[model samples]
Target: MIPTPYPLEEALGIGWYITDTPGTGGVLRKSPEDFAVEEIPLQEPSGSGPYLICRLQKRNWEHQHAMKTIASALGISHRRIAWAGTKDKNAVTSQYISIYGVEEAAVEELRIKDIVVRPVGRNQHPLSLGLLEGNRFAITIRDCTAADTAATVAACTAAAAVGFPNYFGLQRFGVVRPVTHLVGRHILQGDYEAAVMTYVALACPDEDEEVRRIRTEYRETLDAKAAIAALPRHLGFERSLLSRLAEAPEDHAGALKNLPPKLLSMFVSAYQSWLFNRVLSMRLADGVGLDDPVSGDRLLFENGREDLVTETNRRLVSVHLSRGRCAIAVFIPGSEGARIEGKSDERMAMILEEDGITAEDFKRAADFVGLRYNGALRPIAVKSEIQSGVLETDVSLAFTLPPGHYATTVCREFMKADPRAMI
Candidate 1:
C-alpha cells in the first residue's frame, strides 16, 4: 500500500502527471493554474442574544494565514470562528468576520481596513464549527517565461480539457507537519488541551507546559530512530482498547486499562507522517524531482478570502472540472445499505449499538449519493522553468484535501522532483 491516507490511495498510487505550468497570466482558475489565494469576509450576529460588534483580520497579518485568524481578531476566541474548512497561508486572503451584539441596522455599515463586515441573519448560536459550504477562488500565478509562455498555454488547455488530477496539495502537511503528530499524541490521550497547547500554541509567545516540553525536548539534539524508541512504550496500539474503555468506564479496573489513546493516535498519525516523509525523501534521493518544481522555487501570494460553504450538517457537494474527464460527488456520511425488508431494521440496530455508525449506513450513503468510489487515479502534470536566475517557478497543481491526508504524498513526483523539497 502506498502510505497515502486510505481516502486517496487509488488517486495517489496511480502513476500520472499533469502539466502545472499555467498560461502567461489569467483571471480565476484557468487551466494549469489553481487559485493563488482565497479570501472571504465573515459577518454573523454575535450569538450572545444581542449583537455586539467585534472585528477581525488575518491572524498572521502579512497574508492569508490560518482560518483561526477569524477567532483571534474578534477576541471571541478561536473556538468561535465557524469556518467551512481551512485555507492555505502565504497567499492573499480576505474572509468575513461577523460580529455579535451589533444592531441589525448597523451590519451593512460596519467596515475596517482589509476586513469587511456583512450581516448574516440571526443565529441561535454563532455559526457552528466547520460550517463553510465551500469556497470560490481568485488565483494568480505570475512570472511566466517568454520562451515557455506559449507552451504553458497549451498545457493549460490540455489540463482543462483533461481535468487536472484531484490530488491533494502540499499544504496538507504544515511547514512542519511531523511535529503535529508527535505531540498531537497528547490530544489522543483525551487531553485536547495538551494537543492544542503543544501543537498549535507552542509557537505563540505565551507558552504552556506542553509547549515548553515539546520545544525543550525537540531542541535537544537527538536522532529520529532513538526518538521513536524513546516514546512511551506503554502506549502501543491502544486506540481500540482505550476507545472501548472510554465508551464504558463504569468499572474502575477497566477504566484504568485506558492509556492515553488520543495521544497515542496522534503519535501514530505523526509517525505515519514521518514514515511517509522518509520514504518520500528516499524517493527524492533516488532522483525523483528533476522534472518537477523544487520547494525553494519562487513563492507567490495574494490576500485573504471568505467562506463559501454555507452549511455542513448534510452536504452533497459535487466538484465538476471546467475541462477534462473528472469530477467528484461527495456526501456527508450515512446514506446507503442492503435493502432486504428487515435490512433497514438491522441497520438501525447497528447505529444504536456500540459503533456510532453502521456498515449499512455507509452502503446506503454511497447508494443515495449515486456515485461509486471507483478509485481511479486522477491525472496531473507539472513543468518548471528557470529564467534570469531570479528564483522563479516554484508553483504546482493540486487539489483540496480533507484532514488526515498528506499533500506531499499526492505530489510524490514533485516531492521527488526536487530532492530538497521533501516534506
Candidate 2:
C-alpha cells in the first residue's frame, strides 16, 4: 500500500492507498465543467401530490446555499426545501429537491444565475436526506503527470474492482478548514465553549488571506463584537455565532444552538465518519481482508440486514460474500448502543475510550442539539467498475456510487496527489 501525501488525510484516518502503483498525479475540478454529478432518484415523482419535485441543476453552488436561494425566491423558509444528498459546491450537479407548498408556476418564474430548477412532477411526501438510489459522476483529472496514463488508469481500475477502503472523503469534514470533527469532538466532550470557538475561529491556509486574518484575530482576542464587525457578510454562519456571543459572552451552548439543526448535526456525524475511517484503516493495518469476513466480523446485506460471522457460520458467510450477498461492515458509534463484538467495533470502542467519550456523551449531544445519533453500518470496502480514458494530458472517469459513498474516496486511489488537489 502507498501512503497518502497529505498530513490532513493521514490525520483523518485515510492513511494508505490500496494499490502501490504510481498515481496519475492530477488535480480534480480545475473548472466547474471538469466534474459533473447527477443523482439517481430512488422513486420517480408522482404525477400529482402536495410536494413539488424539481430537478435542480446548478454550476458552482453549495447545496445549502442553492436551497436557500430557491426558498427565498419562492418566499418560503429554507427548511421547506429538502434533498436526498448534498452536492459539491465546485462542481456542475443535477439533483432532485422537494419544495413544500410551492406551485409549478412559481418555480418556473424563478430565475437564478448558474441555476436551473425545472419541476419534474409532484410527491406526496417531501424528499429527505439519503433518499436517493445513488449518484453518477463524470470526472476529469487534468494536468496529469503520469508517464503512461492509460496504464495507470487500467491499474487503478483493476485495483478498484477488487475493492478500496471506503473511508469517508475529506469533504465530509470541511475541505477548507476541516474543523467539523474537531467541533464535534468538543461537543461530545461537553465542551460547548471549545465547540463554538472552533467553529467560529478555526483558520486554514486554503482560505482567503483576509478571512484567515480575521479568524486568527478572533481566536487570539475572543472579542465577539470585533470579530463580527471584521467578518464579511458572506460569512453569515460565523457572524451569527459571534452575534450570540456578543449578546451573552458566557452562553457558548446558546451560541452553538443558534446554528441550523442540520448543519449542527453534521459536526457530530463528521466525528462518527472520522471514527469509522480510523477503524477501517486499523482493520487493514491488522492484515484483515476486506473482501472476506472472519469470526466476529459483521456482515451487511444488500437488503439492509446485518449478521455476525462466527466460527459456526464463517463458511456460510464466505459463501454469501462470494455470491455478493453481503459485505463486511463497521458500525459508526452513536447514541444508540453499538455492539463491540467485532474487531472493527473493538477498535472503535478503544478509540472512543481514549477520547473519553461514551454513549452517555452521545445521548447528551442528541439532547442538546435535538438530533439523534443512531449509529449506522458502513461497508469496509467498495468496488466499482470504472470507465476511463485519456484525453491529451487529462484522464476522465465515469462511475456510480451508492448513496452515502464519496466519489473522492475513489478518485484518491487514481490520483495519489495532495488531498487539496481533489478539493
Candidate 3:
C-alpha cells in the first residue's frame, strides 16, 4: 500500500507547516498551458524487450481517456497500456507509457486527440504504478504583480529550507464532487445503499450550477431513470450506477457492484487519505516537528539504509536526520498492522475517535471485497526544489518533487488563497 499524492481546496481547515507566512494573491490553472508536468521514469528501458516505451505529451486529457484512445488506435485492450502515474487532465503532461507486445514502429505511427506519442525506445519491462523517480512541474500563476511574486518567492525559500507538510492535496479526493470519502464511510459501515446514494444523489455545494441542479433532483426523487436522463454523458460513472438502479432499484449492493472495481477501491483509499490529512494537521497543531524526530515517532530511511527510528538508536537517528536521508513517518491506518506507537499513537487514536471509527474499520468491509486498507507509512514533510520567475502579472514556478508528494501542496504554501479560487 503505497501513499499516492494528489490535488486541494481550502475547505479542509488544515494547518500549515509555515503558518506565519501569508500567501500572495495568485491564479492557477488559468489554461492548460498554465501547468506543465513531465514524469521522470524510474529507469530507461533496455534495448531488447517485448514492450514498447512511448513518451507521450498530452494536453487537457485524463489518464483513463488517453489509455482508451491509445488502446483503440493500437487495436489492443486497454489493459496492455501501462503508465507510471496519473497526470492532471487540465495540464500539459509528458509521461511514459509502455504497451505490451507493441513494436516501436507501430507506436510511432499512432495518433490520438490532444496526445503526441513519441516512441522513446524499448525495454523488457512495462511501466507499473510507482515506477517513477518523481515529477517535474512548470506551473504558471496569473493575477500576480511583482509584489505578489516577491512574497511567493519568500514562501518558496522557507519551504526549501524547511520542508512543508505532505498532506495529500485536494486532488486525491475529487475536486468537483468531494464525495469519495463520504461514500467510503458508508461502505465501511456496510451500508451500500447510503454509499450508492451518496455517490449519485448528494450534491456538493461547490459543484457547477447545472450539476448541482441535477443532483438536487436525484436527491429528492431517488428516481434512477430520471437521474440517468438528467445526467450528462460525461458523468459516466454516475450514469452507470443509476442505470443499475433503474434496472433493480431495490438492490443497492448490486448497484454498487456495477461500478468499476478500481473506482470502488479508490473510494476506500480516498477515505484513508482524508484521515491521514487530519492526523498530519493534528500532529503539527500538537507542536510536533515535521523534520525533527520525537521519541516515539517512526523515521523511514529513504536512502538505501535500514529503516530506523529514534526509539532506541537516538545517536544514529540524529546523524541521518541532519543529512535529510530519513523522514518522520506517519502511518495511514489500515486494519491492524501499521499503527504508530507511544505519543504519536495517542494522536492518531484521538483522530480516529473523532471520526467514530477505529483501526478495525479498515479491515475488509462487509459490502466490498478487496477494499481493505493494508496500511503504509508516509513522511510528515516532503522537500521540493523550486525556481520562480516573473513575467508581469504571471508568475512561473518550476520544481521537482518525489513520488507521493503533491505540487498543489507546494503551491498552496506560496499562494495562501483558497486553492479552488486559484485554480
lDDT score, residue 289, model 1?
34
Q: For model 3, how does the per-residue alpha-carbon lDDT over 65-157 read when each residue is reduced to its tens digit?
A: 778678889899877887888788889999998889987778778767788998888888788767899999999888864355776666676
Which stretches of candidate 1 lie above 4 Å from their native place?
A: 1-16, 19-75, 97-121, 128-133, 176-423
The better-scoring model by TM-score among 2 and 3 is 2
In candidate 3, residue 95 scores what lDDT?
A: 90
lDDT of each: 0.33, 0.89, 0.75
Consecutive 10-residue window with the lowest summed lDDT within model 3: 1-10
Tens digit per residue, CA lDDT, model 2, 1-423: 766777889899998788888889989999988999999999998788889999999999977778878888889998788888999989999999999898999999988999999999998999988999999999999999988888889999988787889999998998888889999999999999999989988888899999999999999999999999999987878888899999999999999988777788889999999999898888777767777677888889999998899999988888888788899999888888787787788889999999999999999999988889888889988888899989888999999999999999999899989999998
Estimate the overall C-alpha local distance difference test score of candidate 1. 0.33
Where model 2 places Cα greater than 4 Å from the true spot, the runs are none
> Per-prediction count of colliding residue pairs?
68, 0, 4
Sorting all predicted structures by lDDT, with the top scorer first, yields 2, 3, 1
The per-residue C-alpha lDDT of model 3 at residue 57 equals 94
